[model samples]
Target: MLVVGGITRLTQSGLSIVEWAPLMGVVPPVGEAQWQEAFDAYKRYPEYQQLRPTMTLAEYRFIYYWEYAHRLLARAIGVVFLVPFLAFLARGYLRGPLLRRLLLLFGLGALQGLMGWLMVASGLVDRPSVAHERLAAHLLLAFTIFAVCLWTAADLWPTPAPDEGARRRLRRLHAGLVTFGALLVLQVTYGAFVAGLDAGRAFNTWPLMAGGWWPPAAWRLDPPLRNLLDNIATVQWIHRTVPLLLLLVAALLVAGAWRPAARAGGPHRAWSVALLAGVLVQATLGILTLVTFVPLWLAALHQAVALLLFGVWLAWLHVATRARLAV
Candidate 1:
């Protein structure tokens, strides 16, 4: 859904379907008349008027399908989750904290769906694009949902038996990882800002923007802080800088986790290595995407890798924080 949502935003397909019909929208325009009607309705919006005034019915459908598939997938995920959930609840397989966890997930899923429509609605009024902040919200909420699921599953899994190594304090590594995860979330939010504003297109050069790092951001918005959100150069710079910081922090964590993970008594060694590797891969893809002017495939891959990196971080956290969890 994230990747498709990225594509939907990239192709400017988000506003293709003006209306938010949960059940009735399940079936898309089938016949010619239906297609024309859908297109006509889309024509009423600013995206069509300001961006693609001369778009054909066929062209409209192309963009329409991306958003449709994104929404369809969201619905499918909800149904997939709900059916098993209900069955489990009825069978008494889900209860207590587990039930509460699932219930919370369902509520978040529903809220995410609402956020999606709210994002779409942002672009329909006078502007041809969604608000960058809202786009970031939707993306971050999706990430949060995935993270919650991971954390919940970790809670359900049996904790490992503590060994003599558990005596060794891991407070530093845990703290470092927590910091990295927070930075990752901030980076992702700025990434959405970058995509929303097409910030990557400018500042084609990395390490330096338009020439030097001093400017960081080119234009200063009304309020000083607004530039962080509204300024393209600042957004790209932050996105660029965060990864370097993450890489540095990741390197430190890798170093810290190395011996512990290696020795039998240490934390699981694989997670730290996997996380570092994910960061490297994601960083490489990000550089490539920036240098190449954010090609569709590369950008899409970058988006996928970002999520992958986040997932890895989540998994590592589950392991790193297990001692605390056990308590």
Candidate 2:
């Protein structure tokens, strides 16, 4: 669903549907007259008039189906999740903390649907593009739901009490992983910001932006603070820079955890090592995505690897603190 979203945005199909109709949305316009009606409705929106004024009906269908499929996939996810969830509850299979967590996921999923519509609606108004901040929020919410689901899935397995030596080993990684996790979240949010603002399309060079370290153009917006969110150069520059900082944190984590983990022959250092590698690969993908002018596949790969990197962090953090989490 998330990757499909990347395709939708890349195809400029996000606002093609123009309306949020969860129930009626399932059955897309089928007949020739119905299809023309749907196209007519879309033509009334700013996206059609301003961006694709010459879009033929066949061309309209191309973009419309991407958004249609994205929304359909969302509905499918809800049904797939809720049906089994309720069934398990009725069968007395889910209870206590597990049930509460599942309910939380369902709630977040509902909120994500609303956020998706809000994002699309942003583009339908006076502007032809969605507000980047709202797009970031919507993407971040999806990431949040994914992270929580991953945590819960991991917790379904046993987390036994560690011996004192093992506990001490875990202590070595706890602070580092927590700090890395926080940094990862910030880095990913900036990534979403870049994508939403289409910042990666510019400054198609590595190591510098527009031939400068900070891309002097980054400071163009007034009040410096406003530039943080509204300025494409600033947003992309932050996106490019955060990974370097993340690499530094990951390095420190390995340096701190290596000795104890090797002595104990445990998994702590392995995760730290993997974290570093994941960050490196993701950083490389970001650079390539930019240098290549944000190709769809590369950009989508960047986004997917980001979730995978977060999965690494979640797994490491869970392993580090599972005893406490189990409680």
**TM of each candidate vs. truth:** 0.95, 0.95
Q: Clashing residue pairs in candidate 1, if any?
A: none
lDDT (CA) for every model shown?
0.87, 0.86
- Put down candidate 2 lDDT per residue, 137-184, tens digits, no spaces: 888898899888988998887766665566655565687788888888
Off by over 4 Å in 2: 260-264, 323-327
Q: After superposition, how far is residue 252 of candidate 2 from its true place, in Å?
A: 1.5
Q: Distance from true position, residue 49, model 2, in Å? A: 1.8
Kindly report which residue stretches of model 1 are placed more than 4 angstroms away from their true locations once superposed: 164-168, 216-219, 259-267
The deviation in Å at residue 91 for candidate 1 is: 1.3
Count clashing residue pairs in model 2: 0
Q: Write model 1 residue lDDT over 1-327, tens digit each, in one string.
A: 889888888787888999999999999999999999999999998888887899998899999999999999999999999999999888999988889989999999999999999999999898988999999999999999999998998787887765545435566777888999999999999999999998989888876776897554356687788888999888888899899899999988888777645342344457778888999999999999999998989999999999999998988788767864454
Error of 2 at 51 (Å): 1.7
